[model samples]
Target: MTVEALLIWLIVGAVAGWLAGQIVKGHGFGLAGNIVVGIVGAFLAGWLLPGLGLGLSGIVGSIIYAALGAIILLLLIGLIKRA
Candidate 1:
Protein backbone atom coordinates (compact mmCIF):
# COMPACT_ATOMS: atom_id res chain seq x y z
CA MET A 1 0.00 0.00 0.00
CA THR A 2 1.06 3.55 -0.60
CA VAL A 3 2.38 5.60 2.30
CA GLU A 4 -0.66 7.82 2.05
CA ALA A 5 -2.98 4.84 2.34
CA LEU A 6 -1.01 3.46 5.27
CA LEU A 7 -1.12 6.83 6.98
CA ILE A 8 -4.85 7.06 6.53
CA TRP A 9 -5.27 3.58 7.93
CA LEU A 10 -3.24 4.48 10.98
CA ILE A 11 -5.21 7.63 11.53
CA VAL A 12 -8.48 5.81 11.18
CA GLY A 13 -7.28 3.08 13.52
CA ALA A 14 -6.22 5.55 16.18
CA VAL A 15 -9.49 7.38 16.08
CA ALA A 16 -11.57 4.23 16.06
CA GLY A 17 -9.61 2.71 18.92
CA TRP A 18 -9.97 5.79 21.06
CA LEU A 19 -13.68 5.96 20.37
CA ALA A 20 -14.13 2.28 21.12
CA GLY A 21 -12.31 2.65 24.41
CA GLN A 22 -14.62 5.47 25.33
CA ILE A 23 -17.69 3.47 24.42
CA VAL A 24 -16.51 0.27 26.06
CA LYS A 25 -15.52 1.91 29.36
CA GLY A 26 -12.30 1.03 31.21
CA HIS A 27 -10.92 -0.55 28.07
CA GLY A 28 -8.65 2.17 26.87
CA PHE A 29 -5.24 0.73 26.18
CA GLY A 30 -3.22 3.91 25.91
CA LEU A 31 -1.88 5.08 22.53
CA ALA A 32 0.10 2.15 21.15
CA GLY A 33 -2.32 -0.41 22.48
CA ASN A 34 -5.19 1.56 21.12
CA ILE A 35 -3.49 1.63 17.73
CA VAL A 36 -3.07 -2.12 17.79
CA VAL A 37 -6.66 -2.62 18.81
CA GLY A 38 -7.80 -0.29 16.08
CA ILE A 39 -5.73 -2.01 13.38
CA VAL A 40 -6.91 -5.44 14.40
CA GLY A 41 -10.46 -4.20 14.64
CA ALA A 42 -10.17 -2.82 11.11
CA PHE A 43 -8.99 -6.20 9.86
CA LEU A 44 -11.79 -7.95 11.70
CA ALA A 45 -14.32 -5.53 10.29
CA GLY A 46 -12.87 -5.96 6.82
CA TRP A 47 -13.73 -9.62 7.01
CA LEU A 48 -16.89 -9.59 9.12
CA LEU A 49 -18.70 -6.55 7.77
CA PRO A 50 -18.71 -7.43 4.09
CA GLY A 51 -20.05 -10.87 4.86
CA LEU A 52 -22.93 -9.19 6.67
CA GLY A 53 -23.65 -6.96 3.67
CA LEU A 54 -22.39 -3.86 5.49
CA GLY A 55 -20.62 -1.42 3.24
CA LEU A 56 -18.99 1.73 4.58
CA SER A 57 -17.61 4.39 2.29
CA GLY A 58 -15.14 7.16 3.06
CA ILE A 59 -13.22 8.08 6.22
CA VAL A 60 -16.17 8.64 8.50
CA GLY A 61 -17.70 5.31 7.61
CA SER A 62 -14.36 3.60 8.08
CA ILE A 63 -13.99 5.10 11.54
CA ILE A 64 -17.47 3.95 12.46
CA TYR A 65 -16.78 0.47 11.18
CA ALA A 66 -13.47 0.27 13.02
CA ALA A 67 -15.00 1.54 16.25
CA LEU A 68 -17.81 -0.98 16.08
CA GLY A 69 -15.34 -3.75 15.42
CA ALA A 70 -13.13 -2.60 18.26
CA ILE A 71 -16.05 -2.56 20.64
CA ILE A 72 -16.89 -6.11 19.65
CA LEU A 73 -13.27 -7.11 20.09
CA LEU A 74 -13.15 -5.61 23.58
CA LEU A 75 -16.37 -7.34 24.56
CA LEU A 76 -15.08 -10.66 23.31
CA ILE A 77 -11.87 -10.17 25.20
CA GLY A 78 -13.79 -9.35 28.32
CA LEU A 79 -15.80 -12.51 27.96
CA ILE A 80 -12.70 -14.61 27.45
CA LYS A 81 -11.08 -13.08 30.50
CA ARG A 82 -14.13 -13.76 32.59
CA ALA A 83 -14.54 -17.29 31.40
Candidate 2:
Protein backbone atom coordinates (compact mmCIF):
# COMPACT_ATOMS: atom_id res chain seq x y z
CA MET A 1 0.00 0.00 0.00
CA THR A 2 1.03 3.58 -0.57
CA VAL A 3 2.07 6.01 2.15
CA GLU A 4 -1.29 7.72 1.89
CA ALA A 5 -3.12 4.44 2.42
CA LEU A 6 -0.93 3.57 5.36
CA LEU A 7 -1.56 6.95 6.91
CA ILE A 8 -5.27 6.52 6.50
CA TRP A 9 -5.09 3.13 8.15
CA LEU A 10 -3.21 4.58 11.09
CA ILE A 11 -5.68 7.38 11.48
CA VAL A 12 -8.58 5.00 11.35
CA GLY A 13 -6.91 2.71 13.83
CA ALA A 14 -6.24 5.50 16.30
CA VAL A 15 -9.81 6.74 16.17
CA ALA A 16 -11.30 3.28 16.34
CA GLY A 17 -9.09 2.29 19.24
CA TRP A 18 -9.97 5.39 21.17
CA LEU A 19 -13.63 4.74 20.59
CA ALA A 20 -13.32 1.16 21.68
CA GLY A 21 -11.39 2.10 24.78
CA GLN A 22 -14.08 4.56 25.75
CA ILE A 23 -16.88 2.14 25.06
CA VAL A 24 -15.23 -0.73 26.85
CA LYS A 25 -14.36 1.44 29.86
CA GLY A 26 -11.04 1.42 31.71
CA HIS A 27 -9.17 0.05 28.73
CA GLY A 28 -7.19 2.93 27.41
CA PHE A 29 -4.04 1.58 25.78
CA GLY A 30 -2.37 4.91 24.88
CA LEU A 31 -1.75 6.12 21.35
CA ALA A 32 0.52 3.47 19.92
CA GLY A 33 -1.30 0.62 21.60
CA ASN A 34 -4.60 2.04 20.50
CA ILE A 35 -3.39 2.15 16.93
CA VAL A 36 -2.34 -1.46 17.07
CA VAL A 37 -5.61 -2.49 18.65
CA GLY A 38 -7.57 -0.53 16.10
CA ILE A 39 -5.69 -2.00 13.15
CA VAL A 40 -6.12 -5.51 14.45
CA GLY A 41 -9.73 -4.74 15.20
CA ALA A 42 -10.23 -3.54 11.66
CA PHE A 43 -8.76 -6.75 10.37
CA LEU A 44 -10.93 -8.74 12.74
CA ALA A 45 -14.05 -6.89 11.67
CA GLY A 46 -13.15 -7.27 8.01
CA TRP A 47 -13.02 -11.01 8.51
CA LEU A 48 -15.99 -11.41 10.82
CA LEU A 49 -18.52 -8.89 9.58
CA PRO A 50 -18.73 -10.14 6.03
CA GLY A 51 -19.49 -13.62 7.21
CA LEU A 52 -22.26 -12.17 9.37
CA GLY A 53 -23.82 -10.35 6.39
CA LEU A 54 -22.92 -6.89 7.62
CA GLY A 55 -21.49 -4.27 5.29
CA LEU A 56 -20.44 -0.73 6.12
CA SER A 57 -19.27 1.94 3.71
CA GLY A 58 -17.14 5.10 3.86
CA ILE A 59 -14.58 6.25 6.38
CA VAL A 60 -17.12 6.63 9.17
CA GLY A 61 -18.31 3.12 8.53
CA SER A 62 -14.77 1.89 8.67
CA ILE A 63 -14.29 3.57 12.03
CA ILE A 64 -17.50 2.07 13.37
CA TYR A 65 -16.62 -1.38 12.16
CA ALA A 66 -13.11 -1.16 13.56
CA ALA A 67 -14.42 0.15 16.86
CA LEU A 68 -16.81 -2.77 17.11
CA GLY A 69 -13.98 -5.18 16.56
CA ALA A 70 -11.77 -3.35 19.04
CA ILE A 71 -14.49 -3.58 21.67
CA ILE A 72 -14.63 -7.31 21.13
CA LEU A 73 -10.88 -7.53 21.36
CA LEU A 74 -10.82 -5.58 24.60
CA LEU A 75 -13.58 -7.70 26.12
CA LEU A 76 -11.76 -10.88 25.24
CA ILE A 77 -8.56 -9.49 26.69
CA GLY A 78 -10.39 -8.55 29.86
CA LEU A 79 -11.79 -12.04 30.15
CA ILE A 80 -8.42 -13.62 29.55
CA LYS A 81 -6.83 -11.42 32.14
CA ARG A 82 -9.51 -12.30 34.66
CA ALA A 83 -9.21 -16.02 34.02
TM-score for predicted model 1 compared with the true structure = 0.90
The lDDT of model 2 is 0.92
For model 1, how does the per-residue alpha-carbon lDDT over 1-83 read when each residue is reduced to its tens digit?
99999999888889889988988875577888788889889888888889999999999999999988998898899899999
Q: Write the per-residue lDDT of candidate 2 for residues 2-76, one digit (tens) a residue.
A: 999999999999999999998897666899989999999999899888999989999999999999999988889
In candidate 2, which residue pairs get closer than 3 Å at backbone N, Cα or C atoms, i.e. clash? none
Whole-model lDDT per candidate: 0.88, 0.92
Q: List ranges where model 1 is wrong by over 4 Å.
A: none
TM-score against native, each model: 0.90, 0.93
